[model samples]
Target: MTTLLRNCRPMGGTAADLLIEGEVITAIGAGLPAPEGATLLDGQGMLALPAFVEGHTHLDKSRWGMGWWVNEVGPRLIDRIDTERATRRGGFDPATQSARLAREFLARGTTRIRSFADVDTEIGTAHSDALVALREALRGTMDIQVVAFPQSGLLVRPGTLELLDQALRNGADIVGGLDPSGIDRDPKGHLDAVFGLSEKHGKPLDIHLHEPGELGAFALELTIERTLALGMQGQVVLSHAFCLGDVARAPALYAALAEAGIAVATTAPPSRAVPSVRAMRAAGGRIFAGNDGIRDTWTPYNMPDMLQRAMLVGLKNEFRRDDEIAWALATVTDWAAEGCGFAAYGLAVGARADLVLVEAETVAEAVVATPPRRLVLSHGRVVARDGVLAS
Candidate 1:
């Protein structure tokens, strides 16, 4: 089916009409004539942008559709992990809960997602199984990349390394690792296992690195070394590498990360130290944004809106200029798409027709205000309208 999106500003630019023919944009120009028997949808001169990309998140852990989950976990990472494991042990359906969160993300205009599914000795690859099924179910509407995440340390928890391998062999798309030094107390062992799995399965790596300061810097160096040595350059991503916020180590690490082709994913947490998006981009490094946890067992404070996530990123970076704010917008759109390996993405001719129309005059205003998504399209079909998902 051919659909004509009329009078929409591409990237907050001049008004134009987008002609989509079966999942790909065919033409983009002013006053483009609609084809015979084409469905015409008025854009109302709204800003047209690519659908949001959620580069890092925990889908299996979200309690999105459940009751208000009072977060009573302790301050440390282990506390949260223990709580999550206990909750998982108690048996809440992952596929159901994750589907709820994923649909919420879709309604908010996210068409691509890279979600971490926990893989441990206790639950084994149960989470991975559920997410792989979910990925197949949402094949046409959304692109989901499942990471076989070792939330519980690889070395600390015996047999988890084997389970991660099992997850990769079964269906997980990527190999994920946690704090090598902080959690496992064995950075070398942790990295070796994850990188080895990536090489064996020929998959990518998205490791969660929450270790701060010098400890995190050390882990970053180790990760870079492995990425280069294994020739896994662009295939590796470090999520929440808080060490990048350290001015003392950021410059060198940013340069090294750029050289190694490793991307960084930041949730832009206000309280914690975050990487300078401008500095990283200027240093030739690719940095993207994500909404880490949405009303999960860990924290109750997050939404599924990538636009709001972009606003938080802009605020965290103290971005005031329109261009600077647009850069923040890219963190959740273009940059995030590339980091998550979503090809043929964006508002351009010959790209996929995964677009979001927002009620805004400019891209910067869209990021700052995050007005309701007027309409959302996936595979050139209307998937949502007015913040509600299409049936």
Candidate 2:
């Protein structure tokens, strides 16, 4: 397929014409001539950007658009975990919900996602199955990466390590682990099992850490040790790493993360303080954002909109200047892509023709105003428009 997008601003830069041949962006320039029998789409001054990439999300736990399920306020993380396990014991079909959320994200200009599927004895593989089904169902329209996530713990929860191994063997793209120090109580053993599975299957790892203060910092040190020991630099990601902000050694931690090429995913948890994006960028570490779980049993908050998430990061981080806000926007776009190691990511020529058209004059204005996704394309094919799914 050949398509021409005329007068569109690339990365909030100068307006130009973009020519996409098949799945590759062929040419980009002003006054470029269209090929024979090409489909021409008027940009109408839309700012073109790479489709949002979700680094961390839980598609299996999502209850968006369902009747309200108020989360029980908990003083501890275990409280919420127990509540969620009980609430989701009798498995609900996630196929419908996953499909709906995928449509919502696509309509909002997110074409790629890395979602963690809860794989424990309690939930079994139903959640993983649902997301895998959704992946097959939405093939070509979305790029879905599934992580075999142990929601409870690696060592604390019996049979979880084996379940994670099975999940990785059964179509999951990556391996995931929970809090090493806090929940599992044995950081060494937990990481050994997690890293063992990762090495066994040659898959990457994404660990969830909610441990606070010094404990969190210690857990991160252990994570860094395992990452460096195993030589899994770019292969390891730490999600919800709120401790780097709690300690005075954030600069050193950020420097190590940059040197090791480890990534961080922050959902902008209102209660947790996250490290400065500018500082992390200066240190050369990748930082990204995601919605996590929206309207699940664990929490009643979550939106399938990455743009809204970016705005929230800006607002919660107290960003005032346009450049600061733009930095937040990159967390959901380019930075997110880089964190997830998305190779075919960009609005440049010769890149994948996966992009979104928003009704904004500049990237900063788009970040501040967050205009609706006017048009979204995946691999040169229009998939959604005006908050509606076309394909």
Each candidate's clash count = 0, 0
* Clashing pairs in model 2, backbone N/Cα/C closer than 3 A: none
Candidate 1 lDDT over residue span 234-328, tens digit each: 99999999988864858989999999999999999988889899989999999999989888888888899999999999999999999999999
Q: How displaced is residue 313 in candidate 1, in Å?
A: 0.3
Task: Name the top lDDT candidate.
Answer: 1
Error of 1 at 231 (Å): 0.9
Q: Cα lDDT of model 2 overall?
A: 0.86
Best by TM-score: 1
Q: Report the alpha-carbon TM-score of model 2 versus the true structure.
A: 0.97
Displacement of the residue 139 alpha carbon in candidate 2, Å: 2.4
Candidate 2 per-residue lDDT over residues 127-161, each given as its tens digit: 77778878887787788988889887779988988
Ten contiguous residues minimizing lDDT sum, candidate 1: 243-252
Model 2 regions lying over 4 Å from their true place: none
